[model samples]
Structure formats: C-alpha cells, structure tokens
Target: MLVDQNDQALRIGPIHRSVAAVTLSDLSELSEQRGDSFEVLTDRERALSCWTDPDDDMAAFAVSDGQAWAVLRTKRTHEVDATVLHESLLPAWHVADQQVGYHHSLDQALNATSRQPGLVVAVRPPTLAQVMDAAARGLRMPRKSTSFSPKPRMGVVMRDLRDA
Candidate 1:
C-alpha cells in the first residue's frame, strides 16, 4: 500500500518498497569509502528525486544529514543493497540498533528529521522473490527490514473473545 502526501491510501502490490531511517551518525566517510557506489546529493528533495526517478534504480539507498546527502547504488539488485546496508554499512558507522528508527515512507522519515535533528537514510526494500530466495538460502534480514502493507484494520481483523 502507498500513501500519498495527502495521506490518502492507495492499494497496490509490491512494485517498489523503500524504507527510511533517522539517525544522528555521519555517513560521509562510509559514502566516500564506497566511491562510485554512492551519488552525493545536496538536499532531501533531490534525494527524493533519486529514489522516485525510474530512470535510475541504481541507488541502493540514500543518506542525508539535513544539508548534504548521498545516494548509494550498486550494479546488483536491491536485495544485495539491503544486505550490505544491514550487514556492513550501518555497523561501520557504529550506529546502534536502538539509535535507528525505521519509517515505511520517505515522507515519514523526512518528517521525523524535521521534528528532531538527525541524518535520514532512505533504503530500497527487497522484492518478495528476493526475500524468499534469502529464506531458502538460510539467511535472515534484520528486524523491521520489510513491512507488508495494507495492514488489516485494527477492529475489523480482531474480535472480543468475551462476545463469543
């Protein structure tokens, strides 16, 4: 499911899934080490463009410190990017698991940074096939890595057992 800037819900399948993160860590060094793998940007709007632009799906993830931004890309698919993010990049930054907050949408992430002050890392989510492949290989992704959307409505999906 996708929610527009208006907060209107749009029912859709897993065409493209991206998760955003809010943190206080500086990712420039990591981005620099990655070299051509990362495309540095100037601000959030540009980073948003990098994510939404269909002409370029190369970006695995994008990071911003509210001023400077960098988008990470790979010749491989998003699944690999997700793996590298969880397994390597994040850990190198010394970003504690608790210090990170995951947002299902870019807007939510940017909003979070606006409310507080921190860096925002927007990640491309893995496809269902990629997830299944990982599972078959006995690999595990980090928690909150994927969010199945159009979640069941609270009251509609549950019942009061007492009423039974």
Candidate 2:
C-alpha cells in the first residue's frame, strides 16, 4: 500500500479494492482463443471485486501456459491467513525456490511459458474496498495484488516538502 508520507491516514489516490483470478493455461492456446487483445481485468460484479467468480464472458483475466488453463481463486479464505497467502505466491515471486516464471504482465508471462507443462498465471488487482472487506472478513490477499497508479506524471504544480 504505497501511500503519501504526508497522509497519516489513507484517504486519497488510486486505491485498489479487488484482484483478478489466476488463470493457468497454455500461451498458444489462450493466444489462439483470445489473441493479443485479451484483457486481464474487468469491471466489478456481484458486489465482489477482482472478478472472483468465474464467468463465461471474462471481462478481465490472467493466463499461464500448459495444455489446459486451470483457474485458481483467492487462496486466502474469508479468514485472513497471512502464512497461507504467502506460500501460494512464493513460487511466482521467488524463482530461486522453484522453476517458476514471473512477468510484468500476465500476457507476457503466458507467451514466455507457452511450451511449459503448467504454471500459475494471472492475478487480478484488488481494489481498496475489496481489501478492506477481506480484512473485515478476516481474509488477507497476496502481496502486490493491486498496483495503484502514480500521481500525475506532468508537473502542473510544484510544492515544497516543507510546505506540504
């Protein structure tokens, strides 16, 4: 949760609230199905963020290469179990531990591992609301599940740190 140092309480900026389900499938297979224009995310649904439910029409999603794509959902239950969440994502985040691949975007990773047997791919970015709800429900998502957009790149206004 990268936040403004000045903001003692998080109340502004692009706050994430949901995450996308992980899709482990073959790159060539997905590419043949959805093509390059495949998007990994979609709007909220059923009051649930990150498209937690698997819908026929995938508004957003992530993919991995293998023969078939096995869709995986949030490893953490409504009950927050930090230990379990970390273990599930350890393979992707740490390559030294296992022969896992990580990519900036799901598509890129899917493309790279097209020939591989199977792997974990695709993770929807969680929204702030979803994150809070998960916490309330005692569930904890994997780290880096959601990425907030940076402040305006254009320097329209300038303020000194002392003044801010």
Candidate 3:
C-alpha cells in the first residue's frame, strides 16, 4: 500500500462525508476520484478502535471519559447535560464477538469537530459488517484507521495461536 508524504501516522477514522453522510460506497467513489488507495486490515478475530488526527499535536478525544467531557465542556462554553451525556453519549458501544458499528465511531469523530475547531481526532471501532465487506471486496481501510483494544501489555489477556 502507498503511504502519505507527511510521515505522520493517520490513527484511523470512519468517514469522509459524502451525499450519504458516511457510507462505504460513497467513500470508495470519493477515494477513486481523489486517487487514493484502500488498505484493509484482514484480521477477522479482532475488533478495532483508535484516535488519530492530521497533526501529532491534535489529540481530539480524551483517553479518559472525564478528559473528553472537560475538553467538550470547555470548548462549547455551556453547562453540558451530564445526565443526558451519561445515559446516551457514553453508552457502551455495541460489539459482537468484538464489533462496534462504524456509525458509532464516525459519530464520535464528526460530533467532535462540529463546532469552532473543525479539527478532529477520529476514533474508529471495527464493525464486523464494514470490515468484512471491505475485505470481501479486496479493499481495506487506510492503515492506522482502526485499533484493537486490550492492546498488548502485561496483565492483559494473552493468547498463543501456535496450536490453532
């Protein structure tokens, strides 16, 4: 796959808005029009999620929940509805055997940049349908667009695939 001139990692996201808001078909067409290549990640066993920005200094979403709210509340200059946010905004993303809808990831990315600072830190979750569809079509999301959780670290679940 081809890489960008920036030498900056993409960090992964779900959309490049089209007439349909955020759909794979439109993205594909747009990419073709722009002369961009698609790079799919072929791991069916892992779901993905990660935050990325065009520049290294631009970390949009917060690693922690409080950090996210702090950034949003400070920027919007309003008393954010914590109750509504708690109940709706921060709900656990849906994943099946590890799958969170692309829509959810895109929503976070878009909602994040809807205001004054149009810059965003895209956080994408590997929705099974989208990932599989891309793979089936021989297409792929650009590298760094998605990240798997429980990243390799001490005390996290570890597995050995040698037997399988």
Compare the candidates by TM-score and give the number of the best one: 1
Clashes of each: 0, 23, 7
Q: Any runs in candidate 2 off by more than 4 Å, and if so which?
A: 1-63, 73-75, 78-85, 88-101, 115-118, 130-143, 150-160
Q: For candidate 2, give the lDDT.
A: 0.40
lDDT string for model 1 (120-141, tens) is 6766566667676888999887
**Residue-level lDDT tens digits of model 3 in 5-118:** 367433333332101122333334443554433223232111122222222222222221111211111111112122212222223111121212223343454444442222
lDDT per residue as tens, model 2, 1-164: 34574764343221121122323333334444433233333322322344344433333333333334333333342232222234533333332334544455544554555545445444544445766887798865655454445444575666677876
Candidate ordering by lDDT (highest first): 1, 2, 3
Q: What's the lDDT for all of these models?
A: 0.58, 0.40, 0.31
TM-score of every model versus the real structure: 0.63, 0.38, 0.23
For every candidate in turn, the CA RMSD to the true structure comes to 7.0, 10.9, 19.4
TM-score of 1: 0.63
Ranking by TM-score: 1, 2, 3
TM-score computed on alpha carbons, candidate 3:
0.23
